[model samples]
Every structure is written in C-alpha cells, then in structure tokens.
Target chain A: MGNLRERLKAFYADYSFYILPVMKFALALGIYVLINNRLGYMEALNRLFILVILAAISAILPFNATVMIGIALIVAHCFGLGVETGLFALVLYVVLVLLYFRFVPRDALVMLMTPVAGILHMEAVVPLCLGLVRGPESALSAACGLVSWQFVEIVHDEIAPLKEADAGMLNVLQSIPASLFSPKLLLCVIASAAATVLVALIVRHMTTYTRLRAVIAGAVLYLVIMLAGGVAVGVELNAPAIVAGTAASAAVALFLNMFVYSVDYRQSRFIQFEDDDYYYYVKAIPKMRAGGAKPVRYYDDSSRQNGTGTPVNGQDVDGVDFKTKLEDSLKDL
Target chain B: MLTKQRLQLMISLADFKQSHINTTMRVTKYYRNDYVAVQLVKNFFVTSIAYLILLGFFAVYHLDFLLTNMNNLKMGRLAAVLLIIYLVMLAVYSVITYVIARIRYARAREKAEDYDQKLDLLANIYREEKQSSGNPFGEDQ
Candidate 1:
C-alpha cells in the first residue's frame, strides 16, 4: 500500500499539470454524454464533433467559466424540450447560483460531482467524502449538489409531460408541483446526505483511528443511512445493488485518502525550543518518502576536518566549501 | 446612489468586505472550529433562501389550497417556529465549538509550559558544563 501510494504521489507530482487538464476534459465529455443521453435535446448539440470541441474548451477554461458553460448547455437542452421546461430550469439555475455565491463559491468539485453522483446513484459518496476531507460546512454544498441533480432529473421528467400536454401554461405549471417536489424522494436524498455528513464528521474527529479506518466507517455509515432512510421514507431501493455500489465507492474513497493524507506512522519526533522569554513544544510529523532518496547535506565533512585528518569542532565553513558540498550532495542524489 | 462620494464609499466597502471574506476563508486552514461556525451561518442563510424559493413556487401554483388551509397552517407562526429552531441550533453549535476551542487552547498552553520547563533545565545544564570547563566558550572551543 505504501509503495503504491509513493508511486502514485510521484506520478501525480511529475505530470499533474498535464493530467489535470486531461481529467477535466474527460469530466466534461462525461457530463456531455450523460446530459445528451438523458435529455436527447438536438442532433446538433449531441454531435460528437460539438461535444469534443466543448469538452476541449471547458478543460482549458477556468472552473467558474466551465460551470457557466455547463449551465448554458442545460438551459439549451431544456429549451429544446419546451419553453416552460426552459423557464423551470432557469429558476433552478438561479437558485443554484445564489447558493453557490452565498455558501460555497470555492466548491467547484461539488458542482462537478452533482451530475456524476446523480447519474451513478452514489450520492452518499459526495457527503461522506466531503465530511472526511472538508469541514462540516461542505455538507451544505453537497446537499445543494444533490438538490441540483434532482432539479435536473425533475426537468427531464417534465419533457414527456410537456410534449403530451397541448394545454395552456397554467395547466403545464400545475403539473410541476407533483414532479418537482416529490416529498418522499427529497426526504430520502436529504436524509441520506445528512446522515452521511454526520457519520463522516464524527469519524473525522476520531483522531485515534487512521484515515483509512475513518473512510471505511464513513462508507459503512453511508450504506446504513441509505438502508434506514429508504425504509423510513418508503422509497423503493435495490438494496444489494446500493450496498455493492457504496462499498466500491468506499474503496475508491480509501484509495484517494491514502494518496491525499499519507503519513509516516513511525517517525513522530518531539522537540523543544526557546526564543527569549517564550518556549515552544513542537511535534514534527515527517511525511513518508521513497526509500532511495536522501535529504541534501550542505556542510562539508572535509572542511570540518583538520590537516592531520582529525575532526575539528565548531569550524565555520566558507562559501566555496559550502558550494562544493551542495554540488557534491546534488551529484550523490 | 450614483453620487461620486457614495460610489467611492461603496467601492471601498466592497473591497473591505472582499478582503475580510478572503481572510476568514484562510482562517479555516488554521482554525477548524471557527470555520465550522462560519459555514453553519452561511449554510443557514443560503438554505433558507432556497427553501423560501421552493415554498414560493409551491404557494404560487397552489394558491387555492394554501388559502383554504391558511387558518390551520398559520404561515407566520410556522416562520416563527423555524426561526426559533434555527436560533437553538446555532446556540448549540456555538457552545460546542467554544468548548472544543477551549480544550485545544488548554492543551497548547500545557505543551508550552512543559517546553519552558525543559528549556530552563537545559540552560542550567549548559551553565554547569561551561563552569566546569573553566571556559565561557565551553568544550567546543
């Protein structure tokens, strides 16, 4: 596990700039495919050529700009379905924007995860992961993301109804209350998310447990929450499937935590220092590194040795010796 | 609102607000308890707006149902109840955070005091070594 984590860290450090852009492009493509598959807006918008272009552009653009483009795509798709659907989507978008600015403007990750989690039906993972890695406040953003996912699903549901109904705007608007606010579904999603957040927060505060253990606990808690929440809300759930999916998500979360919060378990050092009147106690945690590397030494052993090859104490080395020592250290590395 | 002085003041105030927000956000890196409180306050306001919007949508579409049920529903009373619930939750969260912060502070103070004692002992040992060697520079010289 340690070796794999080291390799992963090295790989990330070496190619993160390139890997991140490619990952963004892939995420954009995935979103496009999911949206197109669900909405089936227009052939022009759904074209492979257009999606590739959009994904490429989104990958290079700033996160906020990318989110704006995503919003625009959702709007366009909704408009293609019906005017009322478009307006409803606009309202959802406005609410999301308000929530984003007011609470979690920095949380682009949650915004990206919303559609992904919704489509995958692994919504619990978002809250669980956020609670472990982020503060309790991120729970709001995770809930917002889930809500946005539901909003999109609601918009999608409206498409068939809007197409079938030849009635006026009032009649169409009336249909929204039932589809838009299915209290049972909303309750289930919110309850599961809130439960996950609570479990994650509790696990995070368990300083005695390893992060890996905490992540596993979070995943198990998520599964328990979903099962209990589903039963309480009378929501139909494929229990075995959810269990399997959440377990897989938990495994992924554990792997991610390993890379993100890697620490050397054996190398804890305590030291004491003083400056004038004040004293400081420091517990230094040294990160685990690959075995073949060594820290650079700046002082020369030769400079600290006398003419008869005996070690001289408290000898100050000059700049030339220091430069030689640094070069030698670098060469050894 | 469009006056020159007003505009300048508004810009300055906006700048100050932005800087303040940035500083507070950075504080989360060092202080988890404070960040949790800030997040709770922010989430409360944002979620309240979202809930209100959802309610507004439902109320606008189902005006007749709301009107008929108004006597039993008592919207103002419900709002007051929600406000009370929010306040209670906030108070509980604040108290919990305060306790955590106090414990952390106490632990840090204990560590500092321990370090100070160790530092004093080390200083005394160094003084004894120097005196025994009969040189102010000690054995290293």
Candidate 2:
C-alpha cells in the first residue's frame, strides 16, 4: 500500500494539470450519460428539437417570458390544468419574454442571458429537464445535479405512466399531447416561429443592422406552410388533437433546424459560446508569446525599453509601453 | 485562514522578489514549506464541494439503502460501485484543480521574472550609454 501510494504521488507530481481536468470532465459527462440512458425515451423528439432551436435562438429573443415559463412549469405540475388555463399560461409566457426583450436594451439582455446560459444554468440544464420528466423525487435530485443533461431518464419514466392514463387528462396536460384545442401547442408553435424572426432582428442590430430582415422574414413566412399542414392533417380544435399537434410542431422545428444549426458531426471540436469570456484568460498567454521574447531595444536619445508594452524599472522611453516602443520609435522619424 | 494568508504572502513575496531586481536574495527557500500546506487546504475545498453534491444525492435517495442493500446483489452492488467510483473521481478532480492553479501561479511568476530581467537589462544599457555620452550637457561634452 505504501509503495503504491508513493508511485501514484510521483505520477501526479508530473502531469496533474492536463490529465486531472480531462478526467473530471469525463467523469461528470459519464455520470450524466449513464443515468440518462437508463431512464430512456422522452417521446417528444420533434418537440425536443424545437425546444433546442427555441433555446439557441431565444438566447436573444427579448421576451419577459422566462418568468412565466418558470411559473408555468411549476403551475402546470401543480394546477394540472382546468378550462383553458394551459393556453392562458402559454400566451402569458410569450408575452413575458416579449416584454423583457422590448423593455431591456440589447446589451443588458446579452449580459443577463450570459449568466442564464453560463453560470446559473450550467449543469442545471439537464437537471431542469429531469424535473420536467421525472417524479418529485427525481426532480429534486435533478435540481441538486444542476446544469445536468439527465432529462431522458426522468422524462421516459414520466411519459410511461401518462400513456396509460386517458385523453381528457392529456388536454389538461395542454398542447402537450398534440391532439387539438391545445392552446399551449398552438402558442409554442406560433412563438417559436416568431422567435426565429425576432432573434434575427435583434442580432441584425449588432454592430450595424444590415437590413437582412428580408431573409428572416422569409423564414417566418414558412409558418403558413405549418398552419396549412395542420389543417390538411384534419386536426380539429379539440383537446387531444391540440396536445398531439403541439408535439408535432416541436418535431417539425427540430427537423428544419437539423439543417439550420447544421453542425457537421464530423468536426471533433466545437466552441461552446457559453462562458467563452473566460477564453480570453488563456488566449492572452499566446499573444504575449507572439509579441516576442526579449526586452526589445532600440537606439533612443535617452533610455532603452522592454517590448512587452509595459514600463520597467520605473522608467519609460518617451512615455510609451515597452512593446509599443519600437513602433513608436520608428514612427518618431 | 491565517495559513492561506501566509501562503499568499509568501507567493506575493516571491512575486516581489521576481519582479524587483533591486533585491538580490534567494527566495525559493522561504516558499517551500508554506506552499505545501496551502495547496493541501485548497484541495480540500475542491474535493469537499464535489463530494458534497454527490453525497447529498445519496443522502436524499436514502441513508438506509446502504444497510438494506448490504445483501442485495444487483442494484445494491451498482450503488456501491458508483459511490466508490464517484469518490475516486472527486479525488482526481481535486488534484486536477490544484495543479492548474499551481501552473497559473507559476506561469505568472515566470512572466514577472521575464519582465524584471528585461527591465534590468535595459537599465544597465541606459547606465552604460549615459556613462559614455558623458551626461550630455556636462564637462566631457
């Protein structure tokens, strides 16, 4: 035991930085995957894809609706639904998000969304999905996991039980089932399509709004095709039909975006825009190297300076950073 | 807290030593023991928080699952295996964070050293040029 400990200690002394972090990241991802696979089948793959698109684009869609969704998830579980409350909540969520985007400046929205994406929601994402799909126990556990991606397990289990239960209760579950009269489904489809446009508009305002509204306007116009498809499918404004259609809209959105976000699965590396701000911390290291190694010297009337762009020995050659010294000295002539 | 502050003081002392060429003393000795204790404590915070979230999940699941499943071979065995795996992972993560922090601190010290070295060299050149130029407005001119 003592000999093994000594050997392990020696290995750690050498390659702890690279080896250790990779191991931790692997462990975290492994644990999430293990739990997710076992729980199985979230049922609404189309809707799930739609949700991801909504999430990706809605990252900027200025809707005050975040609070409503936060409230809706809680209320949907609690109230279960009565009359048209499902539709009411769906509309409310949209209005809330729209209000948030309208009232807040774009920069502030980005700032707020950064934390929403980066810190508060980091691992909590999967856990929140678990809460959506699992029992109260699993939901609590998921909340604890925080920023987890373990929803498939919990969702599969929840949907299995709902399958045996009848249709009226499903309507009470809202456009959740995709049948008809699912105000929630109608709302989600409408809002998601609008969000794609709204996001394009907000992004257009970035650095210079190049009036590309024509392209995005064409995309939003495709909702007419979806609406026509819904009518042709003979889906009536009934509870079961609405719930089913809601799920269908999600599926369609997913299918379309599969080509839209369209990442080539072949690429081994993808940059997560989330928490990319910290990327500069590491990036600065290379730039410092690129600027060269030595104290850059030049013929000056008075004193010499270093090349790093910083003053040294409490002295500066004509009040310039050492790195900038050579350039400035050249320009001086 | 005192230990951490002292370790920080030593690191900053190292920082001062590496950055300021006027001080020509050996500082690598003063830092040796103090850093070890600080590194261990820092590792504890990391491992403990990681272990905290995992153990909290188990505690939520049930404390009695351990005693009750002491005999059941399938799920119980899985639970035990996962627990052991998680703890081992925790220790690995703790050590990883420790090393990254160490590398960053060392690299910063290296940058300060490189900077101070350049400044010292430049200062020497200035002193030499001034000596040769004979004070520009003085008797030698």
lDDT of candidate 2 over A289-312, digit per residue (tens): 222232444445254434433222
Write model 1 residue lDDT over A116-146, tens digit each, in one string.
7667766666766776667766766776676
TM-score, model 1 to reference? 0.58
TM-score result, candidate 2: 0.26
Alpha-carbon lDDT of model 2: 0.36
User: What proportion of the real contacts between chains A and B does each prediction keep?
Assistant: 0.35, 0.00
Q: Which 10 successive residues of model 1 chain B have the least lDDT summed?
A: B1-10
Candidate 2: tens digits of C-alpha lDDT, residues B1-141: 123443333333444544453322232222534454465565566455545544553443354565676666487668798778766865775565556546645655565566566556644544565666667633333
Best model per DockQ: 1
* Candidate 2 off by > 4 Å: A1-333, B1-37, B63-87, B129-141
lDDT of each: 0.63, 0.36
